[model samples]
Target: MSLSKLLTVCVIAISLNSTAAEHSRTIDIDSKVVSNHRATINGERINYSVTSGTQPVWNEEGEPTATLYYNYYKKDKVDDISKRPLLISFNGGPGSASVWMHIAYTGPRILKIDDEGYPMQPYGMKDNPHSVLDVADIVFVNPVKTGYSRILPNKDGKMPSADEQKAQFFGVNADIKYLADWINTFITRNNRSLSPKFLIGESYGTVRVSGLAKELQQAHWWFLNGVVLVSPTDIGIKRDGPVKAANRLPYFAATAWHHKALPTQLQQKDLNEVLAEVEAFTINQYLPALAKGAFISPSEQQEIAQRVAHYSGLSKAFVMRSNLDVSNNAFWKELLRDKGYILGRLDSRYLGIDKKETGDKPDYYPELSAWLHAFTPAINHYLREELNYKTDIQYKMLANVYPWDRSKNNTGEQLREAMAENPYLNVLVQAGYYDGATNYFDAKYTMWQLDPSGKMRDRLSFKGYRSGHMMYLRKEDLKTSNDDLREFIKASLKSQTHSAKY
Candidate 1:
């Protein structure tokens, strides 16, 4: 049916409660038996689930569509929901899914990896003794067109185009609207509005959370207790701008030089200290070199080229010829070409053997994708066999129908303006040092654009980990991250409660 027709039908079929008129319907999700198996993790019996819940979906135009499914997990007692904070978690790709975080990090079941950080054969799954779900009720959401989310066909049975898909499903407005509906329905159904709510978003999901915070408050008057942004993306879209591009150079230098991949090094200094010098060079000299073009002096250009090569682990001649504007792709391939390996765009620390090893564009990290399959089996086993949840629909873990609406009209300035005006909302951004794709420094610059007041500034906290995009993949980092999350949530909730008292 057409979206308009769907809206008409939904309006007739669904009646909103007076308390939540903005939300369409209440979805009563029955608890299912997911898994019954027990595993000892850190000497404790860890039980898990791969159960699902349905939420009413609305089109980008505020029209109701089909119901959405989410994978949920809790430690042991479903009735003991009071002890646990509600956590709505999501992954990014604008096209990615939530399977990684669900299985690898916070879920009760975790995928196993070898000592070298590679997936082991006969892949083993284990109880996540470190699961934060012990403290929170975790619900993993798959945005539209990801995981099992599909667009209902029109009466004429035609599918939407890429543009239409984005306009109707994936854009910022659409995400916020859908999330508002989903959260409201969930709270109403569970009767947990007083319980603290939290959101955790990985990569582009950070963008989603930032907008959703405001959307939820404005549309539903629901404020989140806290938000966790893992491997955050720069809200600014201009990837090629001199200042923006130059800012990322330090991260590249840090990752490359930290690995001793760089050809030349002044000394064995702290990674942050060395990266500071690289950042200075990038802003003061390298950016100027790129702007000077052919008019720049040969000696000066060569000096800059040598510095870039020294810090980036690329050859001096190659750096000189490229005019020091080396793209991320070239850096990945060129850095370890002699070893016949390429680093991952998502996590440069990971190295795969060759393209044949994984049939991927870059050879070194196909295991990252392979690990997803390993996780799926475990999540299914845990949810079905352990937690005792049974469902027919395939759990939609990830989806690619994320809206990347980066039109010229959607400027960073506009997003900044929105944030500045809404000073009550705070952001907690965490980035991995080894993530070359969305560099930590890039996020720093993006934060500068936000006109936060003193109070709002206190609300914003940025954390950097000596890891990659999926920092939680590292056991130690995951623990630290969970602690960080717990503290942030407690503080935010306290602040909110205190403010309301006044």
Candidate 2:
């Protein structure tokens, strides 16, 4: 049935939830509401069932400590269930809800935003024709403290202490452990054990899944077919000091080219051509100069400063003042400082009007604020009204997952290990050229450093988009990215000539 017709048949339920300490309520910890719907995706009709529910995260003693909210979308009319692919997805913030990829990218519903990704009035959702549901089943998972997922209270109505919560669900290792256990349960309950499983994560979610790739294999004995990293983090790859500082040039050039801030010669050329030039200079000249530091001669320093200022759209004086090293923050503020505007941290294409453009960093993230404005309403309405899953609890678009322990993050190496062990496992990375937070260059660097041996290099691939972090927000990328995912899923599921042996 059409979504409108499906919405007419409401199936609301009361579930346990609370946004604050005083507002706690009692309800079923493990609850679900199923709804059937149809939409035209990729020029084909897709009938799918959506299961919106919460699954319990148990402790070692087998006691329920937390419940995770998730939306599982399974396409109907599949002949062989075991051969079908299952795509598990998560968005990053370490604290962010899974709503992003759920509605905006891979799921059947998307926000009612413009082609350029600006929020529109009459906030709602529309059919996502580019969604990958046409090719594979998908589940958007909400980690603890995100979406409606929360730590449960005891039978006596006492919640776990903050320290206890951290120990169980907050840190890097703790998150991977519980979520790996949760995935095992989810797969088993859904009867997808024989299906080809793939994990896709964005931002910090990249770290989560990279670790899970290894943890699931070692801890749960669950092997995956593929992993997708969208706008990935460093994934514990080390690029400190001069290496880190020099990597900023290509991103700087990309952002500058986007705003037409580059010199007429560079601005006139294509973005890729400009980036190629900047990248070569960065490796051959910028990195070496930064390494030499105060030991470098004055002429070389002047030459380096000129090139940095030229590519970064910053003045020579400013580049010299920064000692030939410009932070992303200063670039955001300085690029359009003369124009009296600031660039969005996540997406440089989006313009922000600050009260004063004199600061090193933006007053607020323009891109995030705009996204929250659009996503917050659409997700709530889609869940409660459209999907017919009722709840008094406010669906958090971005939750307070603070004190997020970044102490021990070796997920990059873990991913390498996972790929090395499982010959069936392949990785596909998607990045946006304009994403300043986890820039495309950084994503490429992470991929390059992921498998140092280079034996598994062919199994890894990268795709860059014209937009920023959530590149799918742009209409064009929305289609291309979903296509990339569809191709990757299909390719990974193909029969391999050799077994998984090193």
Candidate 3:
């Protein structure tokens, strides 16, 4: 062969090798940063260690598919590792980060918000004096695309298509499946297999954890001591037509009473007292009236409208025009419309201003904006400055996980099954009366429908707060809710001789 031709072939081989090396370059997915911290919770000093890290999620072929970021807090001095309960916490949104509960509810650090959860200036964090870390070790997890968690490129540096990602991580069932696997891996890695485990989820996290309760037990052979649902979702328990419409009355009454917009009689009564009357009316009169539809006599419909208006702070004429079925957005917009204000969807306690008062809903979520303003800075500062988990990557507080598959959401039944199979598992539901999105009444209704036979009624309990969805954001509720959680955890601890069978 000619010398020039041989040289050309060698150069071509070198170029191909370079291209292959670029494609084969692997990204680091597993890492950790440990730090120690001390905080005074419930008037007692507690020392704890925090492990902030990213754990890899593997595919069926054992290839790393995604990386999940988590912050695990363990009490510094523990006598028995098994005695120390491990609590896995998650927030909702299907795409939302675990930051809400991590910073505001269960974690040792809290955002600097005012008494009623309004954002305070100098956006930062303070020692959460009510955190449950004193009783149980806690781990806050951020699923794919949330927080710093992300899906990685393939070995060939090719990314998974949107469809593939959804099939693996974006749906209700897929979410539970992978999260169950991730949690099992986390437990094994942390050596907490023998410890009594608990799952606490807020908002949509309730759905995630309710499903997790069963998934962990059935698929992973891991049983939990308790499951805490904070501001829970419907959990796949159906509530359509009249049932759904009627359930909104109690929440309306609560929000109206909060805004001082209720009738004089209700305004003068205590919150719980007014709610009792409204709830009774909702179940007895309102639901039947709604179920009757347009077939009912006009006089009877008028009377029902009057009562609904009385409870909802909406005009009788408006309620009548709505055909006695008011939507949440319509109510939020119409409740304070005359006053040139709009009630917040998540927390009606907060007022918002819209471009015009003529819309059916507010232009944006006021409560959410306030939360992001407070939480974004606090989390960014705390995770990097305090916890020392350094990364230039933008911490996604809420990412785009749209095209989210919501089908086959039988999580309520899944939870019921978990309870039936594991007598050790007890469920605690916490909700805020004023949370319009996942109203307290709906949470109660879900609990009632979760077990049709009512066989597990004794194992389920619900707590109502005076605040909004993230009830723990309220100063009073922050302490009270955490106390409630602490009590539930302690009560759920099984005796050494406790049997799995009933």
Error of 2 at 75 (Å): 0.5
The C-alpha lDDT values of all candidates are 0.66, 0.91, 0.92
- Which 10 consecutive residues of model 3 have the lowest summed lDDT? 19-28
TM-score ranking of the models: 3, 2, 1
Work out how many backbone clashes candidate 3 has.
Answer: 0
Ten-residue region with minimum lDDT total, candidate 1: 24-33
**lDDT-sorted candidate list, best first:** 3, 2, 1
Off by over 4 Å in 3: 1-27, 494-497
Score candidate 3 by lDDT: 0.92
Q: How big is the positional error of residue 148 in model 1, measured in Å on the Cα after superposition? A: 3.4
**TM-score of structure candidate 3:** 0.94
* Model 1 lDDT at residue 258: 54
Which scores better on TM-score, 1 or 2? Answer: 2
Considering lDDT, which of the candidate structures 2 and 3 is the better prediction for this target? 3
Which residue pairs clash within candidate 3? none
Q: Candidate 1 on 250-299: residue-level lDDT in tens?
A: 77787786568865444377777787788788878888877777888989
Please give each candidate's TM-score.
0.79, 0.94, 0.94
